[model samples]
Target: MADDLGDEWWESQPAAAGSPGVLAANANSSDALCGPSKTWIWTELNQRASSLQKPSGDEEGRDTEMMQQDTAPVPEPSQETKQPMECFLTQAKETKEETRKTKKWKKKKISEILAKSEPKPGTPGDLQQLIKDHYSGSRSVIELEELNLPDSCFLKANDLTHSLSSYLKEICPKWVKLRKTHSEKKSVLMLIMCSSAVRALELIRSLTAFKGDAKVMKLFAKHIKVREQVKFLENRVIHLGVGTPGRIKELVKQDGLNLNPLKFLVFDWNWRDQKLRRMMDIPEIRKEVFELLDMGVFSLCKSESLKLGLF
Candidate 1:
C-alpha cells in the first residue's frame, strides 16, 4: 500500500505540467548525461534539412559555375587553314577550263595553218617551168618522131597522112624552121629536125597514090635546106589524098629516090643503138611518144628500114 502511494505521487507531480523552468531542468539533466548533444543534433539536422529544402546560395553558385564552363566558346578553325582548300579547288577548276580552251585554240591554229599552207595547182610559173624543163630536152624532140601513121591508117588513110602532116607543119614550124636556120650554128636542132623530116618522108613513102610530086618534094626540100644564102619561102602546099602502097612503091622505085641516106645521116651522130633500144623499152617513153604522135606533133618510122641498123 505505501509503494502504490509513492508511484501515484510521482506521476501526479507538478513538473509534468511543464513550465519553461521545468523544460530547462529536463534539457539540463539530458545534457549532463549525454555531454554536448547539441552539436551532433545540429549536424544531423542540417544534413537532413538541406536534402529536403531548395538549394542554398553556395550550391547554386557551384551549379552556375558548371553551366558557365559548358557555355564557354571553343576556338574556331583558323582562316589560314581553311583558305588553302578553297583556293586549291578554285584553282583546279580554273586550270581545267584553261587547259580546255588552250587545246581548242591549238586545234584551231593547226587547222588555219593547214588551210593557208595548201598548194595551188596549174600555176602559170609551173606550166612555164614544165615546158622549159621537159619540152626543151632532146628526149622530147626524139619522142616527137613516133607519129608516123594514124593507128587506123587503112580505114582512114586520106585523113591520116593529110591531117597528120598538116598538124605537124603547123605546130612544129618553130622547131622545123629553127632546124633550117641553125643547121650550122646548132647541130642538135639540125639533127632533131632532119630526123623528124626523115620520119615524115617514111610516112609519105608508105602512102598509095601519093607519089610525092617532084614539085612538092622540091618545095619541101627547099624549106628544110640548111643553107643561109637561099631565100626559099613558097606558098603553103597541102597533101590531101591517099594513094595505094603499090603506086607509092612504084613511084619511089622508078625515081630510085632512097630516103635511107638522109635518115642515116640525121640519126648517126645523135643516137647509139643500145641507148635507142633502152629508150624505146621504157613504158613512159613509149606512151609519151605515142600520145605526141597521136596529136600529130611528129612522126616515127623503123630506123632499120632507114639503114640506121648498127649491124
Candidate 2:
C-alpha cells in the first residue's frame, strides 16, 4: 500500500519544465540563473524608496520658501506712516523761508560818513547807533569844552588823584565841606560807571570816609545775578553806585536805580586801561550805555539837571 501511495504522488507531481513555480524556485538557486529575473524586484524597491524621499524633498523646499518669505526685507514706510520725517521736512522748509526773509535786511548807513553828526530823530535803535559811533573813535574823548556841557552840575577833571577818595575830594570839594552838616546817611546820589567790578571796587575804596565808616556797595553784573542785584539795591541805601555799564543799564531798566533824583553821573572818560579802552571803547558796554541813555538818562540830561562828569 505505501509503494502504491508514493507512486501515485510521483504521478500527481507533473514533470512539466514550463511551470511558473519551478522556474521561480530555480532562479533563486543560483546568481547566473536569477540575474536578469531579480532586476524587476530590485527596480520596484528603488522606485518605492525614491517616491518616499520625494515627499521629504518637497516638504524641505516648501519650508525653505516659507523661511525666505519671512526673512525678506519689508518695503520702506509709507509717507503717511512717517509722521516724524514729515515734521522734520516741514521744519526745514519753514527755516529756509525764515532765512530768505532775513536776507532782505537793508544795509546800515555809516553814521560818520554823513556830514552831520546828529542822528535822525526816529527809532531808539537809530539814536543808539549814532551814540555808539560817536564814541567808537580812538580819539573820542569828552573834552571840558564849555560848549559841549553847559549849565550842568557835572565837572571835568584832568586826571584821577592818587586814590579814589582823593579824587572825590578834588571833584566834590563843596560837598565834602558841607557833608558834615547833614545828619542823615547820604543815600546814593551819584552813580559811578566803570569798565569792570574790580575798577568799581577800586573807585568805591576811594569813597571811604577818612574819619568814619566806608559805606560802599558794588553793583556790577560780574559774579552777581540780576535778581540778586535788584534785591540788594531795593534793601540798601546805597550812597554811590560803582559798576559796569551793562549792570547800570539793567538797574535803570528794572527801576532798581532811581535816576530821577540822580544828580551826578560820573564816567571814567580819559582813564584807558592797558588796551587803551575807555568805557565807550567796548561794544557790549557801549551798547549798554546807549540802553541806559534811552531809559530816561538822556531825557533827564536834556533838561540839564542830571550832571554828567568825565572822571
Candidate 3:
C-alpha cells in the first residue's frame, strides 16, 4: 500500500506546476530579476522630492509677502505732524528778534550816557561852584576862604562864546599893545595853564588865529629839557606861553619862567578829556595848579595886575 501512495503523490506534484500558485511565484521572480537600476530609482525619487519641495517653498514665500504687507508703515493722517518743526522755526525767529532788540537798547543806553557825560558851556558862577566842589574835602576852611575870587578876579567871559582864539580875542583886546611892550626875555605876557603837553600844543595851534607872528613858547615838560627851555626863554622874548601846571610850577621854581610880565593867567578849566575829566578832576594836576596859583598868581590877582581867565 505504501508504494502505491508514493506513485500517486509524485503524479500530483507535476499537475500542481500548472496551477495559480506556481504561476504567481514565477511572476514575482521575474519582477525581481528585471527591476530598475539604482541611478534610475534615485533620479525618480529626487524628481518627486523636488516637485513637492517647489510647491512648499512657493507657499512659504507667499506667506512671508502677505505678512510684510500687513506690517508695512502708513502715511501720516494730517499736517499736524509738522507742528514740531514749525514750532522750532518760530522759537528761533523769536530769539533772533529778542537779540536785535537787546542790541538796540544797549546802543540807546550808551548814547544817553555819553550825552550826560559831555560838559556844557560854563558861566561866571561855574568857576566858584567847581572850586568849592573840587576843594571842599581837601582844603581847610581858611584855605577855601583864601581860594575865593570875586567877579573882578575872573576875566569878562560873556564874549568867550566859542573857540580859544575867540576867547583870547575877547579877553586880551590889547594883546598887540602888550606884546609890543613885552621886551623882557624868559618872560611871557600871557600864561595859559593846561592839563597835558598835548593840550598845551593844541592851545598853541589854536593861538595862530589870534596871535599874528607874535612869539609863542611851548613850556610843557615833554621831549624838551628844562635847561633847553630856560636857554630858549633867555634868548627869545615869548609873548604867550602855553604849558601844563606841573611844568609851569617847575619852571617857576627854577627861575626859568618869569611871571612879572604875566597879565592873563588863563585856565583850560571847562574842557573835558575823553574820560570826561577836567584839569582839576585829576589829583596831581589839581595840586600843581593850586601850587602854581599860590606862587604869586593869587597875589598878582589880588593886586589886580594879573587877571584870571577861565577858557
Ranking of models by lDDT: 3, 2, 1
Better of 1 and 2 by TM-score: 2
TM-score of each: 0.23, 0.47, 0.59
Off by over 4 Å in 2: 1-153, 160-163, 176-187, 209-214
Tell me how candidate 2 scores on lDDT. 0.62
Q: How many Å off is the CA of 7 in candidate 2?
A: 99
| lDDT at residue 265 of model 3 (Cα atoms) | 85
Per-residue alpha-carbon lDDT of model 2 for 115-206, expressed as tens digits? 35632222223333456565556324442121132335445453433345565666666664333443323235667888888788777666
Q: For each predicted model, how many residue pairs clash, with residues at least 3 apart or on different chains? A: 6, 3, 0
Q: Tell me how far the alpha carbon of residue 264 in candidate 2 is from the true structure, in angstroms, after superposition.
A: 0.9
TM-score of 1: 0.23
lDDT tens digits, residues 131-198, model 1? 34444554565543332323222111122223434433433344333333432211111111112334
lDDT of 3 by residue, 45-116 (tens): 456546654667778899999999999988777765557888999999999999999888874443476587
Highest-TM-score candidate:
3
Task: Determine which window of 10 residues in candidate 2 has minimal summed lDDT.
Answer: 118-127
